[model samples]
Target: MVWAGMCAAIDHLRTHKNGKLIIFEKGGGFGGTWRDNVFPGCCCDVYSNLYSFSFEQNPDWTHIYPNQEELLAYLTAVAQKYDLYKYVRFNTAVDEARWNENKKQWDVTVVVNGGKDSEYGSGYTVTSDFLISCVGQLNIPKYPHIAGSDSFEGKIMHSARWDWSYPLDGKNIAVVGTGATAAQIVPEVAKVADHLTVLQRAPAWVIPRHDSIISEWRKSLLRHVQPARQWFRAESMKARESFHEAVTQAESAKAKQMREITLAHMHKQLPDRPDLWKIFTPSYSPGCKRSVLSDDYYPTFLRDNVTLETRTISRITKKGILFQGQESETEFDLIVLATGFETFDYMHPLKVFGRNGRSLTEIWHGLPRAYKGVTIEDVPNFGMLFGPNTNLTHNSLILVIEAQSRYINALVDAVLDVKAHGKHLSLIPKLEVIESYNLDLQKTLKKTSFADPNCNSWWKNSEGIITNNWSGTAVDYQNLVSDVIWEDYEIEETDGSETFVLRRKASTHIGRVNEETHLSTSTLRSAFVKCRSFLNWFCYSWNSQVDTQYEQVLKLSSDSEYNKPSRRLET
Candidate 1:
């Protein structure tokens, strides 16, 4: 677990009887994207009420869409509230995780930077029964393919890695790429910059959002009344689901109306600058590219000091940026490449070795496909969050992540049962299962806006396969991951000796255990509400063996080693 996605995975695992969670964050602190992306006016597109862990919802958001600082503070508070910092090893980056067939464990390598001492300066290895890749799709930032990015004499920076020390109060700035990050940065920079030039390769549809502050009374209602908070959250989720047409059906009447709504705003804002309107209007479908929501992004273009460049970029010179086939160049004191992340790379910057010494990157060959976008065929005992085709265009990604973590924990519990049986086990999804699933997935995604060929986005891979997002609504993904179909996996059992128990379900001598250690079925079921039926949700009759076994599992989690919180950094 490296970033926000992994932080969530860590949170889920800690609650279960799963093994110890050692979080290796490459940064000095947690919060992932919220911690790293500190560009001017950078904020979440989704409403704050819904953009959080379902287990722990915050009712104190000042704005509907919280700013970077507020989002980060919220995440930090979440980590503190959960006591997650103690288990975290900050400044430690995980390099590779290889599955050991003999030990049936994952051998992980990590390089530690800025640790307490030189003991871990050269890095070390750790082994665990399960491996989860929570390194999200947006971890690595993508830079523009300019000829002289490194050679540029001026201050150059990426939106993800904003350089705050460099002053931009009265300097001429060039912001590249008209994406989400650029959309927010351009407005704030133009406020004080002498001249701000926005470089646009493609235009995205801009929707109006009433991103106003939440009043004290409303915040109090959300905080004091539980039903009110739930109602608000439910309505916000429903609003996201209402975008089904704009995201999936471009030719539909609703999609057209949605398009007109954005154009109406543009018509009202850019009446005097019709040339700019033509340049800003997108020829592609409304949902082909990610739609931007802002109250001021369009109006900021009307400022006298702000300029929008719609031409192709040729290269970057020592002084400024040069345009294609144009002799003239725009001089700037600083440049911010608001270009997004390398999403098509999928699980890039991390090496994962699965069955038969096959690397995950080599298996996909730069293309990612998964069973339900959570499980893979070759990667035994390994799971990932926000994996291929799991990103959502309509609902908050937090919902998808919640579903995924629940499903993953279900698998982890299954593995834990096998470990308790004094057996080495490995569960990998069947190839036929994933192939069939992906075949239907590709067919379904073809009709969605993510697969639109008119505009380019990181949503699709080089093969034109929509690998970055889920085609269905958030609720659909929730139902799909609600159950863990055991038959879909190929389970291997080795007793650590020459003997092998192949394709065997976890045997606990069901219905037989000492009566003295028995716990009631109702009591066991109530113990773990989140993992309700953790021991056995499949079997109809409650077994005494499972009851005792479940008690042992609970005991493991409640034990001093697991229950005792490590030394955490106080907020």
Candidate 2:
């Protein structure tokens, strides 16, 4: 859906004006995550309004939680609506993007149809001013490392790579990991499978989805009187935003209430087994992990045909799975792994070389850092939509993506301005700025639900640092990206100069002068002299970068313009 919207925007820029856009997809089609995950009972966890692009709202959503197929259809419809098909080149994967400092363009190398050995054959290179990576987090499917995984006689598959050709009717199925995919799959397969075993590491906190079909009249009302639908969406979004604040804020009443509600739901569902409840209930607080919504997931577990196993698996033998304590091994006709994807790797199979021949991997070796989670230093004319620390466990990710799109567009505008003026410019955030931002982010992350040691989730890396998730509310992020701070970056202009010289004023404060007069160099010296008598000598270093003219302006003014503080800035 995101790629389709991006293409649509490009198309709008094209025929309506003289714009160029080329979309490359590794797969045969352009649905992104929707095209990849074809597992049974796969549906969106977020509400239809929040999940969809704000620019394109589907009032005609068949179910409250639209299935993958319906979502893919919506994307297709969106593509057709904006005539974006012409811009898309399917069956092409990006191999590398090298930044050309001289030309100020990205030299992109793409492997076409898996190279010469495959159908399309050979590789090609394309250069463009701007490069946008729309490949999302959930595109790749993860398979668990198990003994005899390859040696299994029966069919084995990841939930994302479901084989429709092999039927599941009356088969003895063993599903590993009861995450979102397993939650949906269990209900669907329970009806058909003779016996199903669910291997769960830890039970998820499930909320009621309350999914239902939209009536024709409701659709009509939504189509004509769209404000009504908009109002509903607004209210829903407001509630979600409030929830985000409640979760982030320490020991809030709203957070307590949300926790109580989740606990109540869990108790209501599993009244019989306290042991199961103890295992299922999270040690950490709610909202730490991605909150799952499903009415059928708990009820599916109650089915007589299905059995839930919390036992730790020793290994996967050729016949079946072996539990740590169990004497007997559980055999299965088929096995499905619902392990999620490696979301940390933003653009897999795509090698990016920035200025000074630095790979993105080398830059972000330990921790993923980006300026405002969108733009990275040294990677000229490249912006990521839904980049590092932008993924939200609460609320909508689409909101973040939209904000990123706006930032990218603004960046493009900045680049165009440079081009039109015939000025050689490079926009890269300062190293100090990015480092400070990351430090602040780490401070806030330490206090969040994700930092809870009791819980182990995919949101954190091996070091238990959350590389995903925004530290604050969506509104905060919106305000941060709404306007670009030119001072935060260095904009260099090169007119065949022997060496590039930065033309921005240094950010240092000199000594203050009197309230009435501007600060002259003599006055600054006198102020520093006075300060040295009382305070430490190192205080003078703080004002070293302030030029005489700017210092004079600061001295003349009441310092109100510079220090009219509002809220403290978050990292």
Candidate 3:
């Protein structure tokens, strides 16, 4: 599912130019995550107002946090408004995108017509001069490697691929993982299921979210009073701005205060279950992992049928999961794996080949970095929307995506300008610029508590290097790329001629003629009179009013004395 970021980029490019945009939607249609993730109680972690594109806001959002179906419908509406469906080739999955340096275009390999009618037919190649990859970071699911996990005969489901046909009522269900996905699923399932066992690996820094229904009157005010929406969005953005510091401050006063608040919340929810409250206290600092937001997740442990298990798994059988130290093995009718997506894995499942056939993924080696999180110096004419170092803790993804889109649009125009001037352009960012930028980024992050040695989170790679999040705020990114640093780029002329020509020799117009030599005296006046009458008649007809100007011209033209030019319109 392609989200608003890619949609806005395509719309901008298409509106500015008349070129056809061929969207390779791997899924059946648009909606990206909203269409694919339909688990019970699925809702956006981000507020609904800021989640949408800036240009196309959905005032009719049902709640502060919209559910999956509402967000999906909003995406579908944006697609229809821009007539984006005509350009989309649905059910076409891209295998590899190769940059053709010789042809100066991208050669894409895709599997088209994968629905029932065509039966997932053969592969074909399509090419484009420029490529924008919006294949987002959160699609692939990660399964746990428990011994005999697959040997179970009962129904198994991933959170991303929920099995809706299986009912939870009167069923003993086992839920795996306690990240963001499991937090939402546990509360909803415990309310209906006969019994629920939540298997958790580590505790998350869970916080309370003030998410409530956006009343009809408020939605009405926001719809009609446009500033109300803008004001609300501004307030929401300002509220989240300081959270990044709170999470990154380690055991500092701010971090300690946040930890205290969270502990208090947990205690309030689990007043009788001090053991459950202790289970939630994390060994690492806050913001080590992306924090979860929900009101009912902690209170779920109070339910009589809910069980929170934090033991290490020994193995799995058809009956259920076996604990490491305990001999009693639990059995369940169904198992739901809320194992999260590969968030740190950028552009997974799609291999990209850039300049000289070098694999872009091979260069990163599971740790991706880019200049401004969009441009890789080695890769020319290729860009990404939500690339590495772009995930946010205290800002909107849509805001960052728009900033990247606007900046990348400038790069796209720069490439087009080079071609329009009869030159082949090859842009490779200078090596020092990228090095200096990343160095400063790492330096900034190291001082934060998130960079503490004890903190092990998805924000970092296997080598203990922070790879997923931005070192600064989203506003900092917006200010950094507000203008394209053309000087930092190595723009070479591929034809071996020269760099861009700045100044040319002076020149002047040579062809000239006197108006009197080519035209007669009566001819000019007669033409002016005829033009005046025609314009007058046209203006009146266009305004849906009648005029006698053309009739007067006809009467004057027929007169014997009217062969001479009329003097009235001479000026």
Report, for every candidate in turn, its global Cα lDDT versus the true structure: 0.74, 0.69, 0.72
lDDT of 1 at 569: 11
TM-score between candidate 3 and the true structure: 0.84
Candidate 2 achieves a global lDDT of 0.69
What C-alpha lDDT, on a 0 to 100 scale, does residue 216 get in candidate 1? 66
Per-residue alpha-carbon lDDT of candidate 3 for residues 491-561, written as tens digits (9 for 90 to 100): 66667654453321121121111111123324433443465454334333322211221121122123212
The TM-scores, one per candidate, come to 0.85, 0.83, 0.84
- Please name the candidate that would achieve the greatest TM-score relative to the true structure: 1
Q: lDDT per residue, candidate 1, 1-571, as tens digits?
A: 2334554555565665345677777888877888888989989999788787766778899987889898888888877876778777878888898989889899999887774833646789999888877888886889767897776788999999998999999999999988778888988999999999898889999877667676665676568767546645754655576575666778876577677778887888777878878888998887787888876889888899998888788888888988888897778899998989988766677788999889988888777888999888789998888899998876688887777777777677667767877877788999999999999999998987777788888888766788887887776677678667777888777754323234444331111101011233355445424343422332222233234322222222222221223311111
By how many angstroms RMSD does model 2 differ from the true structure? 16.0
C-alpha RMSD of each candidate structure in angstroms:
13.3, 16.0, 18.8
| Per-residue alpha-carbon lDDT of candidate 2 for residues 430-499, written as tens digits (9 for 90 to 100) | 7788888878988998898777776677778878898887887665676667666667776655565413
After superposition, which runs of candidate 3 have C-alpha atoms over 4 Å from their true positions?
A: 14-17, 116-121, 497-571
Error of 3 at 408 (Å): 1.1
